[model samples]
Target: MHALIEFPSPFPEEPGVVRLLEPPGSDIEALRARLRDGSYGRPFVLENGGLRALHFSLGYVQSVMKISDPCALQLGYAQRMTAFLLFNPRPRQMVMIGLGGGSLANFCHRHLPGTRLAIVEIDADVIALREQFCVPPDDERLQVIHGDGADFVRDHPGRIDVLMIDAFGPDGVAEELASFEFYERARGRLSASGVLVMNVAGNKETYARHVERLLTAFDDAVIAMSVREDGNYILFAFRDASFAPRWKFMRAIAIELQKRLRLDFPGFAQQLERGQALRLAQRLSA
Candidate 1:
């Protein structure tokens, strides 16, 4: 029988759980090769065990490649989007483009209870490996579709209240995904009052250039949240107009969510503020 491996968490668990597993070896290139050859999916530690990596399944959708030395979700992109949209009760139809470990999707399925959730991913092997982890299946609220996220939404005619672009490729986001044509298709898949959340990585300043492209498709766009130094940022774009975040309300919701999820709310709140402030500063500098 295979041995069960367990990892340890360094942070206070309130809003979410953070775990760091032991490292497989020192050779990352070998590890990447194994992944390419379909042999590696187990979790491993890096940076002298300060950082960790894992293959989180998206519940029969796709696998999210996560490097969690800093405990960043989507490298910290989802942190901001979760703060803004998690409590927004208006989105009954939620579509997620990427399904890494089903974190945001599972959280919504468990907490919202009434929302219909659909995740689109391109990899079939990732779907087959989901049960190897703990992602549940046969849920009435959640459905996993096997296909390219961009194409799925492009062909999907129904209106979506919230459209989340979480898809990422080995070379980073595909060229077609960040293209103006894809953004237009995403806009067409949304309702009049819909909010589009996109997760992006790399230089924060260069991120605005991508946002500029999205603005062509969206009437008004806003950087809902951003993290400094970390390669992840979450941008929330509106179909008709941008919606201002209610900070006090967001704080209240963050506190409540932390309590309900048994996670440390203080850190979550600080991260939210940091993300908002960074974006504001970036806007001023630009």
Candidate 2:
């Protein structure tokens, strides 16, 4: 269903794309450099079988969005992260420390109409592809900043209601984002009722280090639920150490959210409680 255009351009022209549609938007040179030089292991987008995905490596997929439905989170880890809604379903002020393909950002912008969102991303090249991924442009409720996530959390002016950090690099969570200092700063950046959600990656040893730092930084008020895909773990750390969630209520919220957001909410609710219990029992036995 594609008609090749009788036109000339530095890049391959899209099939069936004849006219400008509107005006030239994306910086062709930026994209070209990323393609030409590999952009020093920069993330790339792949489109296949009606799905578009962000790839950090040939074998690893960081994020995926349906071309037919962009905001729908196609990755299991991302869906697990949405369990944050179980903690704070309606956050007024939110800060997200990554903008991979804007799955969370786009969903927040479209669905959470009352919340103001500020997204900080370290890669400008990735930010440039926002339009390509259907990420909405900056507006009153949204601002995507090209900056280091650690610095953004450190220098954030005031406490926020919710802070979600999913910033990861090719190998794993970047060194800066995984450090004790960063977690402390993230704790300081949250309000009294704030919750911090992070997508944690690593094997046994690295995972232990991350858990230790999170427990120390947030005073041991952290809960983790494993997303059985690609070994991704979602961590929920509370700024307030005494904040305890009841299982019955959480399951109720999970049911409601599953109906609304199309994620495995009830499953996450059950898993988180069980995981926390297992950890506590192991500690007591020790």
Candidate lDDT (C-alpha), each: 0.59, 0.78
lDDT tens digits by residue: candidate 2, 1-286: 1111122222242221111112245555554454444452656566656776665544566677788888898788888887778888889889998898889888888878999999999877677667757899889999999898888888889888889998887767788988899888899989998999988876768667977998899988888888776688888999999888888988889998888878889998888898778767876897
Q: What is the TM-score of each candidate against the true structure?
A: 0.66, 0.84
> How does candidate 1 fare on TM-score?
0.66
Q: What lDDT score is found at residue 105 in candidate 2?
A: 89
lDDT of 1 at 107: 61
Tell me how far the alpha carbon of residue 39 in candidate 1 is from the true structure, in angstroms, after superposition. Answer: 11
Where is model 2 poorest over a 10-residue stretch in terms of lDDT? 13-22
Question: What is the C-alpha local distance difference test score of candidate 2?
Answer: 0.78
